[model samples]
Target: MYVLEGDKSAASRELLSRFTAPYYLLHGTDGKLGTGIRLLDCGDMMITMDVPTDFEKSLLRGKPAAVHP
Candidate 1:
């Protein structure tokens, strides 16, 4: 898996946007204890965002990612 880790900065956004294909931005929903990170898998690249607060969550709020078993 291609993991790209960074904060939500201009550089991060520019790097994340390099993937031209479709992807999903995954985040925690409060029920499950996670790493407090946001992930996006665009087939080739896996993007991750560190979101550990309510403000951060609100800032990154967008479409939900569907995880299958």
Candidate 2:
């Protein structure tokens, strides 16, 4: 797992503020390693969380697959 060095909490707050949509900060995930915090873009809005690798994979799995000819 890649760890981003520096003040992640402040950086995360700044990132979240850029979006116009409402969001809930999952503070529990702050400062946790391996479970990197992320800003999820949901087209109309967004979400922020710090989930384990398996949960992260599950989130990706929920997305629709692209088709290639």
Candidate 3:
């Protein structure tokens, strides 16, 4: 499985953009936790694991993700 580990400060949009592909961005919607993040799609399919947060349930927000597109 592809894992993105390291300090958030070290992670940048440019670096993440490199993963974009001509087709679908597979292995995306897998699993994640911690602070939320954003996702940019090139009409690709993203896979994410179910991680409904308690905060979201009470706050009426969406499921939290390491990234969100």
The Cα error of candidate 1 at residue 13, in Å, is 0.0
lDDT tens digits, residue span 1-69, model 1: 122233345443444456444455433223222322222323332443432223334355763422222
Where model 3 places Cα greater than 4 Å from the true spot, the runs are 23-26, 29-69
> Compared with the true structure, what per-residue lDDT tens digits does model 3 show for residues 1-60?
132323222223333446566643535333344322333233232432232323234333
Q: Quick one: best TM-score, which candidate?
A: 1
Ranking by TM-score: 1, 3, 2
Tell me which residue pairs clash in candidate 2. none
Better of 1 and 2 by TM-score: 1
Question: What's the C-alpha lDDT at position 6 in model 2?
Answer: 28
Candidate 1, superposed: residue stretches over 4 Å from native: 1-6, 22-69
- TM of each candidate vs. truth: 0.27, 0.22, 0.24
Output the worst ten-in-a-row residue range by lDDT, candidate 1: 28-37
Question: 51 in model 2: Cα distance from truth in Å?
Answer: 8.4
Residues 1-69, model 2: lDDT tens digits: 222222344434443345342334332334443334332222322333332333333335795322111
* CA lDDT of every candidate: 0.35, 0.34, 0.35
- Candidate 2: residue 9 Cα off by (Å): 0.6
Q: How accurate locally is residue 31 in candidate 2, as Cα lDDT from 0 to 100? A: 43
Candidate 2 stretches with Cα past 4 Å from truth are 1-8, 21-69
